[model samples]
Target: MDGVDLGIEPGCIFGLLGPNGAGKTTTLEMIEGLRRPDSGSITYGDHDLVRSPAVARERFGVQLQTSAFFELLRVDETIDLFASFYRHTLSTETLIERFELGEKRKAYVQNLSGGQRQRLAVAVALVNDPEVVFLDEPTAGLDPQARRNVWDSVRQLRAEGRTVVLTTHYMDEAEALCDQLAVMDHGRVLDEGQPQELIERRQPGAFIEVAAEVPITGDLRLPGLERVTHEGPKTVLMTQRLDETLGALAEWAKQEGVPLTGLATRTATLEDVFLQLTGRSLRD
Candidate 1:
């Protein structure tokens, strides 16, 4: 976080990505007015965030990683309580329907499943009808279907022209939802760009992956290979000159008497970009 000499465009979904304790949450907290930066400025639209935080709050919606809603309160009661803080709010009926909480509207908050609780928090965020929304790990620990549902609401937010700033460790979610993003590590921005553009910049060559039962001992310095890296049983080779690399590998496989196993070549992706930027797997 070399101070965001950056701005998240209105009506855009901007993702902040990093591993745990990399300061992604810190940066987002500062922007959401949950934590103050030790020495920097945050301006939200025309409001001076430091000087007029209340004004900024009137326009900001934030969903923290962990919510502390009253466990004994009904879903409608929780929504109503939060809505009372805002100048304007969507009706409880509409929020419940939008979040698919209709069947559970009268249920206690603590009785809701993890995914349901997450959705309730999202619904609470929108109660203010703010101009900007921040979601921190909105779908962490969720099942596949639950994650997809969360994504659907985010897409709906984009369609409604609301600015969203999301912080998540999941690379696939960043690729799917973000138009522009910054990857952070150790409280610093390591890379920033459109996901596809970043991938192209990092790996212009084809990346072939090989997971061998045996280790590759020697450095693979062939005529066509551009880069070689190994992690445990996995190895990735980058090559612009694909034909030559594949041909040489075929010859070497025969000569060395090693089986070519778990070999695959796919177009580069955001995961590759993260790997190139951080020198580690995104999930690591």
Candidate 2:
């Protein structure tokens, strides 16, 4: 990580968003005190975490991108094992109930489904009842329903007054769940703000999507159009004056004998802002 900086507010869900190898995990490890930076300071309130690693370990709970526990261990036993490591802890039964793993309490870790395992991982992370929680790509491999389940858990943590910090490559997830976000690429922070604020700052206008049998080349000039980009089969026109641009597009299509098979207009989104800033898709 190079010169990546962030300020996470208490009792809020803060996110670090980037694609693979963008230093999101590395940054998290440093802050978690699992890894030390060569030159930099990591602070938590008045304590310097870099120098006092024990302080960070004591006050923060982390669920890594991948967690490995003994497959033979039962769900409740797993939570109990982790709890024993911490001086302060929440009860295993309480964690199981809160994370909706009550039925699987006696089941082995290997016997749980993907979603159940994820919930179990989070339950173990909270064994210490730390003030701050860090989840690294918590829902990376889960199904839609399971992803939403984990999102609800993260929200619950905030509602309970614990600061939540997480990393994600999913733009929609970050936009929906984060109170504040830092967009990162190539091991550096490109931008940071509230999701909507970042969108408005980087992509101020709206987009009109046009679908045509033929390619909508840039040569087709339209009034009030800022730029044109092709995404898959759709040609996206970015513009500030929506009405003027729409009128001009219709007129141009009519004159060119082109049919507007599918046309839609909508406000800018975090995806648009990411494309504008990085000149590539977030998934890339």
Candidate 3:
């Protein structure tokens, strides 16, 4: 992790996005004082974190990828146990309500569902009421509903004026939740900005996806077509002019006697940017 410089703004939900083994967790651990970099500066406001690591422990809240609690402990009891570690902490009752864990407060940690366990994990992180919260892969294994629940909790943290730094491999999660994002790979940051800003910078054109019995040939020329590639059963066309490209594409299909099946059009996304920069999918 050499020369990894970042400026995380106050009160913003900053995201660290990358694939597995990309060092997102290592970076977050360094910032959260769980692991120390051999040499680097981590400054929090006017304080230098490297010089005073204890300051980070007091001011930062952390939720790791797998948050484990005593299986026998009730939800409320788990929160209380973590609260006991901090001199200043939010009330356990408030933490439960904030994370929508009121109904599960009496349930043992082992009995809770995946979403419930995740909510409890977040509740524990907030027990310290720290100014900066770090979450690593907060929504990695949840279903859509559970993932949305986590996203809401994260936004609430930002609304309360706490700086939230999270790491995720999910592109849509990064797009919807992050106020600012850093795209990382191989222990380095490739780009950083708002989600849409990075998408526009890395992949400016719109995407046209079409499914055909016979894939389009490489030498085929279509108006406004910038690039063409295959993804599974679909041929993706990156186009500069949507209308011109669509019309020309339809005509070409008709001339070639090929049916354009499952045709779709949409703007570029963060996944596109990651692929462009790394030549690999985020899931890879």
Candidate 4:
């Protein structure tokens, strides 16, 4: 119920992702030494994470999917408290500016917006100047701009030579930040690879999205199409041979006297890769 097999490498953002109850968090916790695995080994760089947990704790910064902080304490004060635990800490003024918390530094936790609180949480995690960072759904509830802000901070971590172990349901986020990733399900790793590699392996052609009021049945086979499926009134075709598929689709439409008013084609993505492997939606 609680173990993982992650062959992590340094200077990489490794994403371990899954739906609820998939043990993603548990796997991360074990690696971070926050919880003991029932039976497994967690080696980070040269340190045995489970055997030398004290060493692991000192080398990593942690941000849980959800966190609670002192509502009465000011933002800067909260960071100061966590800073006191470590031998070295980032300057309060620098951290405040880094996370764009300068204005809210004196504000109590309860008064901050959902996004502000998340930034503060990240600020506190980096207070220790850790070599690796574990961020679980760091931008889960943030708005678009706030999410981008968090993404920028993550890039800075990588530029600073800090490894990041992250988990997120946002497929785009994984593509944007991670050097490699693993998609999990039912407490097992379903797929793992670089974002580009996974997409290339799973699908090779541009996605042609065809929306029809009627069923897309009756032999509307497109050339180079490996698969065709329905989502609501839309039919998606995935194929490496797009020219043949498009020709076949055009003929099929003419023969059936059907109109694909919303037909669109675009490159494959991490989201498409996940759907091809899982056969289920990420939000599912």
Best by TM-score: 2
Write one digit per residue (lDDT tens) for candidate 4, span 24-122.
888878877889876878786677878988877777899988868989999999999988888888988888999989899899999999999999988
Candidate with best lDDT: 2
lDDT string, candidate 2, 120-223, tens digits: 98998899999999999999999999999999999999999999999999999999999999999999999999999999899889999999988787586778
Off by over 4 Å in 3: none
Order the candidates by lDDT, highest first.
2, 3, 1, 4
Provide the RMSD of all predictions against the true structure, rounded to 1 decimal.
2.0, 1.2, 1.5, 1.7
Query: Is 1 or 2 the stronger prediction by lDDT?
Result: 2
Better of 3 and 4 by lDDT: 3
TM-score of each: 0.92, 0.97, 0.95, 0.93
> How big is the positional error of residue 187 in model 4, measured in Å on the Cα after superposition?
1.4
Selected candidate, larger lDDT, 2 vs 4:
2
Q: Which TM-score value belongs to model 3? A: 0.95
Q: Candidate 4: which stretches are off by over 4 Å?
A: 1-3
Clashing pairs in 1: 1-187, 1-188
How many angstroms is residue 110 displaced in model 4 relative to the true structure, after the best TM-score fit? 1.4
lDDT of 3 at 279: 95
lDDT of 1 by residue, 1-284 (tens): 56565578889899998888888888888777767777778887677787667766777888988876999999999999999998888888899999999999999999999999999999999998878889999989899999999999998998999999898899889999898889888888888888888877877889778877676768676667888877678788889888788788878877888777788887788788877788888776
